[model samples]
Target chain A: MSVSTVRPDVYAQVQHFYARQMQALDAGRFADYANTFTEDGTFQHSPGAQPAVGRAGIVAELERFHERFADDPVQRRHWFNHVALEPLPDGSLSSTVYALIVTVRPGGTPKIGPSCVVHDVLEITEEGVLTRSRLVTHDQEAA
Target chain B: MSVSTVRPDVYAQVQHFYARQMQALDAGRFADYANTFTEDGTFQHSPGAQPAVGRAGIVAELERFHERFADDPVQRRHWFNHVALEPLPDGSLSSTVYALIVTVRPGGTPKIGPSCVVHDVLEITEEGVLTRSRLVTHDQEAA
Candidate 1:
């Protein structure tokens, strides 16, 4: 049973945060995307994989991931759904976000690429919301 | 630009409703799953595909889908994440739910199956919450 204690605005903010993060990644603004996390943020791309810790490390890892589309003018968009947020005992919040990545090849229709999900541990403070740790899991058959 | 006017309780209810629907399907309780929709509920398995209209039709379609594993006792579970809800202009709420289906072959570890997303138009009336229409889309390469 889930309680309705979380404010509606918080949900909206989280959604917006994800949207902006996706936009930044799509636009090749890795720095902007990395800035959404805390100074010591952690990003794990898959199970049993090492996480990219700290903003600099996250940016580096993301850049490496983007290398595939570097030469080509590929279009990328992330669609997130089934987002669930829960309060944590550490005065923070956790969110489970399911995502679908769509890629458009040159002069081709958009095709679904990967089905990914992120478990985000977020800290909300007066300074603003920050993602402390995010563990991402995706179908191994992602194209 | 989204506004946070929707009640938090609505989000909780939508999440719970989806959970129950998935549970019923996994348990092979087709009737219970069908009951989650309205009298004239519609379910679209893929974009531009013919939908199963009405509760009876939904039940029939779902039963047909389950026929593949009818001979064997297959384990099924659905994981839904990143659920986004927005208030629509027609007084119905819209939800974008990302779902991953996991299938466990007899005596094997669970493997991911189709990764799909459903955009559901929900009606919350005094009678109860109902799924008016659901549009599902998925990766063409999904197995």
Candidate 2:
């Protein structure tokens, strides 16, 4: 019988972290979302693009993203599903999740944005919070 | 310092399997795609749907799917990326991949279909072929 080596609690913590992170982003709480990462966390929008490193950098990038939809009537909802987390050798965990971004506008049908996969390297901070190190791998060229 | 427990060869194999499977589907080789599965393998299109069990069932389902675009000037390309594989204690390997399906129609803008995640349970057969057991876990209801 094949059984998962990861503890059930680890899965629970990872899931909850993702849920809260998405909520913070959808609520335009850039600071809260950035707090989910480590001090030197990184968010790579695509494979060849420059990653936004550190909490400050992440917040800056997300703030700019939120600014795009601020004046417009468009709302973006990020749906992350089918998350799989595995414990790595050094105690940090690796996770993969598929993100579906839905764009909603007044008098317009909801449109789905680019579907991409995010592979995350997560570590538990001293506060026992799950913090991301690297995330999001896409096919786009570097900015 | 962190190192992956999954070997380099394992990643190579998983990547090759997805590449071949997608090629087979795109080339309309339903049989070839079906043959990638075990005799009693299953394909689940969504979370709560009846899976197409066995090779014959897989072939039949895929053939019907192919027929939908046969006469139309539509092309479907399945891109599987961000693949993560973990070795199970029972010798089987578990993998998660994000799939982006692009649909292109004659004289129409190419559209992206549902972006979803697929968690596959793969086992190597006696003949050293990677065979999948369960595949495709999406948020949408089963068709």
Candidate 3:
């Protein structure tokens, strides 16, 4: 699998795609978040975890994840950096980024939650770039 | 003041420049970090703060800043996100990013320091992309 640097236009498109996707998820727009993915997209939270397959399944899993924080007043922000994009031979793009989960409550200092590395396979369609597969790995687990 | 999105190649170049620049600063390579800037590059930590002018001055100021934590065992990491790039009419690139300073002690969780927005004027010379001027604004102060 040869991975090469993506063109500038492709990089810009991917960045914008993530910006919208993360914002939707953080703002509790589960359906909108799922829309950023393909109909058959898969999301694996971690290794050995059952993957959330397909758009509907992804939304269901995200809702369950949000339920865990329903009673919490803390706001979570996803910060991504070191976004490295690679062009794959199969025409899909490979994007790897370091993701930081920052949580802050009203009148409190922000804290860093789990640090993760996310690997995403992206494909371009009539609607622009969308995720085809996503796998997140916790930093500690990787270490 | 017309700003437009940068070409894909420029974006990649800027990203790589930052990866090297930030690593040099965090690893205590003050001179190496300073070299990432143009000879007359300036760094202003916050609005109304006296800016460190030139590479020599920038290195000196950074050294002093590091001295304040010399006795501390905490490791500081600079994580930047939402890196937006624009092309300026003068052949300079304007880059803006949200920066988070994360500090962690041995065996302890990471805590976020001041959240800041950094605006940088970048120029590409024979040596690649270099910072011509940088201004950082604290989120709290902006609010």
Candidate 4:
């Protein structure tokens, strides 16, 4: 058997941090998920040209999600992929992950929504929080 | 207790495949890593204007990685960020994945090398292979 020795201990923790973000969002716990980042961290949909900067921007942008789905279903699932991990010189682990996040519209078929492929640079902070610089590439434009 | 509930399965699978490719390269398995894509996959590095087309083109470029590295100690990690996964009506996943790739040279320093952030699109085949389109994106040239 080709055992997948993905070093779950060190890298697994990194993935778990990411998993939390997805879980919170799926559970309609956006506030909890948004707080996962550091105060000075960034979340940019597009990297170089233009990006929504900082925590406030991130939080505000995330708000649109809930607002858009204010009357939508509370249950959903977010799947991520292309997760890559690397150990930094500071003895911390960083990773990049992508996932297909599906929000099941209540009382309707589970329609495939917007897909995102992200570039994330994160380190496990002293307090164990993940501090990251994120750049999101949008494959599907807003409908 | 929060979990990520992203949309689309192919997006995650594509990301998984990309991550696996990097891992294989770190293990000194370049050929194996390169073979993960279709025979006509295109690879665009730089700021994008032009892409290296065809599997042969992509392979020729990536082979340089093998020639440059002596062993597995050389680690190059590609971190991805804000991913947008789009589910096509045809059932395939159309994705825009933004990546921040940090490369580590094998020398004792082992600190960090320069990084490149790229936006790429992938077409996942019915047979489970991931392929890049020969066409380039309009914004790929900007940054």
Q: What overall lDDT goes with each candidate model?
A: 0.77, 0.70, 0.80, 0.56
All candidates in order of DockQ, best leading: 3, 4, 2, 1
Clashes of 3: 1
B18-107: candidate 2 lDDT, tens digit per residue: 655665665578887788887888888777678898999999887776677677756555767788877779988888888877665544
Question: Which 10 successive residues of model 4 chain A have the least lDDT summed?
Answer: A1-10
Candidate 4 segments exceeding 4 Å error: A1-8, A46-54, A74-76, A88-94, A140-143, B1-18, B22-143
Best-performing candidate as measured by TM-score: 3
> What would the per-residue lDDT of candidate 3 be over residues B1-143, giving only the tens digit for each residue?
11134555666677789889998988889899899989999999888889999999999999888888888897888877766666789999877776888889899998786666689999987779999999996654423
Docking class of 4: incorrect
Residues A1-143 of candidate 1 have per-residue lDDT tens digits of 86856577677567656655665666588888788888999989887789999999999998888888677766666768867999888878889988787665554555666888889998876545678999988876454
The local lDDT score (0 to 100) that residue B139 gets in candidate 2 is 47
lDDT digits (tens) for residues A68-103 of candidate 2: 667797777886655555577998887766565788
Task: Quote the lDDT for B59 in model 3.
Answer: 92
Q: Write down the RMSD of candidate 2 (Cα, Å).
A: 10.8
Q: Which CAPRI tier for candidate 3? A: incorrect
Give the higher-lDDT candidate: 2 or 3. Answer: 3
Model 3 CA deviation exceeding 4 Å by range? A1-13, A16-77, A81-108, A113-143, B1-5
iRMS, model 4 (angstroms): 14.7
Every candidate's DockQ is: 0.04, 0.07, 0.13, 0.08
**TM-score of each predicted structure versus truth:** 0.61, 0.55, 0.62, 0.47
